[model samples]
Target: MSGTGRQLAVTADEVVDAELVDEGAALSPAPADPGATPAVHTDRDRHLSPETVAAIEESVADSTRRAYSADREAFAAWCATEGRVPVPASGETMAEWVGYLTVTPRKRTGKPAGPSTIERAMSAVTSWHEEQGHPKPNMRGARKVLNAYKDRLAEAKAEAARARQATAALPSQIRAMLIGTDRSTLAGMRNAALVLLGFATAARVSELVALDLAAVEETEHGYDVTLYRKKVRKHTTNAILYGTDPATCPVRALRAYLAALEAAGRTEGPLFVRVDRWDRIAPPLTRRNKDTGIVEPIGDPAGRMTAEAAAEVVERLAVAAGLSGDWSGHSLRRGFATAARAAGHDPLEIARAGGWVDGSRVLARYMDDVDRVKNSPLVGIGL
Candidate 1:
């Protein structure tokens, strides 16, 4: 029978094999029930070859794989709870699920999923069904349901946009953050360098954490940092020029940070790493003193920083600077565009600087404050 005709079963083995088994594991046998009908195993339950499994897994990025896994689990859980078949979810079932996601508050966040999240969840559900050899659910009803929630979604989005606009750090605020950072400590130096480089490059948090020591090349003018575009997986080079002032210059800050790393004999690996509460870089291994039985960490020169870690650097700096507004990793990128526009740079130039391939509209979104101040007809009008 075609996959679309398959029915969802409640057996543990069936559910596990259909959704959780990604490593080509052999499926468990169905429960013994001589009085009942025999269980039918589709090709989906068969153990895939290791090579085939590897190839399939490698087809998507690791982040995408993780998201898809979470999505599948959520869908499966919902199905089990509702006593509905997940494998062959009908259009009506999907429509109801979409509606539930829209109106329902998630247990963890205590907030309804946004429109983009709902759309992605639907995509994940579709992908999971297709992977399990089931026909994709017709989404016509789901689309209508989504449309019904469109106004609420738009309002939620508008609120979020306003929040972001409020958080866009100005040049003075950026300077405050930089000056407030205590550069003597290891964590402070690293954070200062990170903030400067991030602002100068207009880099995403992912891009900031993805930097490697080897990717930075010294040039006649300043330094050329090679960054791999996360979306396109393409290499792009950005230049960090030396600032006239030694204190606020990104190049100087990075040099001081590198010097500190070198002083600690760290010559290779990730450009940024996690610093512990004691203001020390976390080492790869922990060593115990043979005599005193004191455990000492040997810093890991090759350790990499996560995107969350990068965001913390921003937040901590913001707190130190005594700024009252909300701050996040994207604040630096937004700050860059806003600062550039305030500095009299055009939209296209700001877009190119910030790697905004979408166009001026996106860049303008980041520079809302600047646009409001400069482009408003009421700017110079007498009341």
Candidate 2:
């Protein structure tokens, strides 16, 4: 089924040994059925070995299975230390046992596992136990523990927020980033277009990279972009926003890029294409030759750029502009918001322009020196 909730016809089905059992199996403490009891068979005849457990996990997604495997391994080690049964734990026993994992020093890191990590371990083990037809431990308490951990994280973020009103590249810094780009060449033009789009729209690096040739339209007022999906929210509609009135900066930058793209004879698809410094069309960086300077067409022309690629573009531009430290792609988005507010745009107006769900989230992220200066003591004290 798709997210629209429409079920598609199944073409084929693969059989697996483990079946998804009833949800009640996790809480029920009795055998599956009360009908005429079949002859009891003890595991002494043919016990399920570690190899069998590992094989069962192979059917799940790689990430999910790895997590479950890690959790089970941790629990098995704990069982060996406590001299308890290495299999299905009773409700009371699991509660008592998981409590120690919260404070127990990790064997590798030699630091106590945090509550959230421990809770995940418990959830994994309980899920496996339930799958094997054993009554699983109560998990409502685990949710409470996880919530408390989340609260701590929230508090930490709040503390950091107090120390810093959002900081982004200043006007001088933005000017520097632009000057740093090699504007004499096609590569330079592409880089300029990338940065300009990000700055004008306050777009995340993901959104900027996902743009297709068809999505951009030159409007009478300015360049209007239609982004299909923005990470800031969950929606199916296109994000329509005017890039600046008259859109000279972004439009000029884009025109240079498009001219280069057309000259290279790519007219029908992606808005951006990678070109090497030597003017050769090459492939993406790979493990074998990642350091070999090559630019390849990204497979998904409308998909987000790799975080590494985005960072590289920003860092290179920042270095060109004569700044140091890890200035990443995100700085452009932050740069736009900060610059807009500095220009005296209202908070709600800025938020609306930036496609923020509300002004608070925008304020929380973009509030900075401009905000402080505009509302500062010096502004009104003399009068």
Q: Which model scores highest in TM-score? A: 1
75 Cα displacement, candidate 2 (Å): 12
Query: Which one is best on lDDT?
Result: 1
- Residue-level lDDT tens digits of model 1 in 16-38: 34467544334555556779887
Candidate 2 residue lDDT tens string, 1-383:
11111111111122223444545665686765768676676765335455554554444444455666677777777888887764567555565566666456778778556654675677677666655555676666555555555565467673312222223655567667786566768777877788777667666666666677777776665467765334344322223334443322677787777777778776756675566669544345433336876655545443334445655787787877678654777687677778778887787776665666664554555765466777786896767
Global Cα lDDT for candidate 2:
0.60
Q: Which lDDT values do the candidates have, in the order given?
A: 0.75, 0.60
Which parts of model 1 have CA positions greater than 4 angstroms off?
1-64, 130-136, 150-166, 285-301, 341-353, 356-364, 367-383
Q: What lDDT is reached at residue 205 by model 2? A: 66
Give the Å shift of residue 61 in candidate 2.
18
TM-score, one value per model: 0.72, 0.53
